[model samples]
Each structure stands twice: as structure tokens, then as C-alpha cells.
Target: MTLSVKAVAARLEIGRIDWSAYRAPASGGPGLRDLFLGLLDANDESEAVGCSLEYRLEVQSMVYEVALPAVGVILAAYAEDLPLWVEMEFLNVLHNIITGEPHRSELELGNFDLVDRCIERARDGIWVMYSRLSKWNSDFLLDVLEVVDSDRERFAVFKAGFYPE
Candidate 1:
């Protein structure tokens, strides 16, 4: 499944949507570096400095919490193939949370090199963080994991000469 808002809504069985809340706010808070560092910091207590947000991305409920490293991992892992708009939307949410500002720039979603580098840098952290994700995020991650498994299966079949090109 694609990571569109509509797809997420359908998966969540949401009936209607209000799009305004997902719009990016004006940029004013911290920069991306601080935002990412905050995510990676394990000592940050949610009860003290938590920014909990509830968003309906096209109708699906996304209760996002700042300081959840898994959220960053999931976004980075799925960053490569998503549509540009979807990638922007994800970044907008993160920016909103971090800097209290909406994202005004677009990132090249196809550039997996940065993502790969980050993954290599945070391999163990990502692994530990994945288990700490909330159920909603974990479910979404499972869906993507299924897609990866399906792709692996298809590739294996092709290698076994099941289909001729």
C-alpha cells in the first residue's frame, strides 16, 4: 500500500476528514538538527517537555509524540519510495512538532543515500526504538514490513526462473 493519506484513512476505517489541521504551520521553533537530536535523546522525558499531537492525515488517526525515536526511524526507512507530496507531509508534521513551524521546503524523496547513511549511523538505536513505538505506529510499520517481504518473495521467484523476461 502507498503511504498516502487516503490509503491510511482507508486502512484505519475512518469515514470523514478535515484537512486543515494537517497544514504546516509557520516556521519559528528549533531547527531540524535540534529536532532530530531531541528524537534521539533517550533522557528526554515526555511528561516534562512532551509535545503530543493528534492529526488525521486524510482521516486516519496519527497521534504523534515528540521524543519517539521510532517515529523518525519509520519515516526515514520509508522515505525513499513515497511520493514527494507525502514525503513533504511527513516532514511538515515533524517540523511542526520540532520548531512549531510548518515545513516550507521540499526534500528529494528519491535520495535514499541520506537515509541509508542515517540508518548506518543509528542502527542499534533504530532497532531498540522500533520496539518502543506505539501500537498505531507499529501497525503501520508492520504494513510496510509486509510490503518488503512481498518484494523479497517476488525477487526470489524471479531468481528461480519462475517468469521469463
Candidate 2:
């Protein structure tokens, strides 16, 4: 489905969360946009300093602490009118998060749906982030463990052929 505010609202179950409270002030605060940018721009935490944020692990602290909660806002922001470069960045980041590791376990139901859409787009030759993602050969196990996350994840992972049913 096309990414838009309305679509984001419905798909993400948006408006139930106070997104503003997590906005990164000039001083920096918990925000998914910033985290997504950091992942897209820099190589890692050490290099991301100053460019986007001061990297640190805040388990309970508010530096995004985690990205799952902010996926809605992140997607909504993407649907908004962003510059071309910014839009591409968001797409790339979303693709990476859905397809790559994000230091987390299984994806939420909503995010999992997004993954389904993305994979479909790629396989259909509309877009690509390793269409052979399901192909069992290169780093397949790690990909399954890192991206699959849980029993609920089996649907997508199974379709991807990460494992036999």
C-alpha cells in the first residue's frame, strides 16, 4: 500500500501515542526519525556523534530506548511531504529495519505487515533489497534469527524460506 498519513494512521494505529513527547529537542531526546537518520547516514554509533546525536545506551533512559514504539511516527513522517533525498532515506531505512536487524526480537504485527508489503514489492521486481532474501545460502541463519524474532514471525520467515514448515 502507498505510504500516506491516512494509511499510516490506520496501518500503525496512530494517534493513540503521544508522539511529540518523544521529539528530539535541540538538546536531543528520544525520537525514531533521528535514529533512522543515524542508521542511514553514519556507519555506527561512534561516527554518528554530533552529526545526528550523542550515542549512548539508555535502557530505561529516553533516547528512543527502542524504536518499536516510534514506528508509527516514523512512517507518518515519511508519508508527509519530505524532500526527495529525505524520502529515499526513509524508504531505505524502513527497508533495512524491516529486512535487517534492529537490536530487537520479533516485529509487531503492524511492522510485520509492512515487511510483507516490502518483500512483495521486491519480489515483484518493483523494488529490491536482496530479492533472494528467502534463498538459503548466504548468512541465512543469522538473518532468520535476527529478523524473524519469534513464533509469530514464522509466517514471513516461512514464506521467505528461511526455514522449512
Candidate achieving the largest lDDT = 2
Local distance difference test scores for all models: 0.31, 0.38
Off by over 4 Å in 1: 1-30, 47-138, 147-165
Which residue pairs in candidate 2 collide? none
The TM-score measured for candidate 2 stands at 0.31
Lowest summed-lDDT stretch of 10 residues in model 2? 56-65
Looking at model 1, residue 108 earns an lDDT score of 31
Q: Who wins the TM-score comparison?
A: 2
Error of 2 at 97 (Å): 0.6
Q: What lDDT is obtained when candidate 1 is compared to the true structure?
A: 0.31
lDDT of 1 by residue, 27-144 (tens): 2122322333233332334522433222421112221222133234335533334333343334444333332221123123233233233233334333333343334344343333
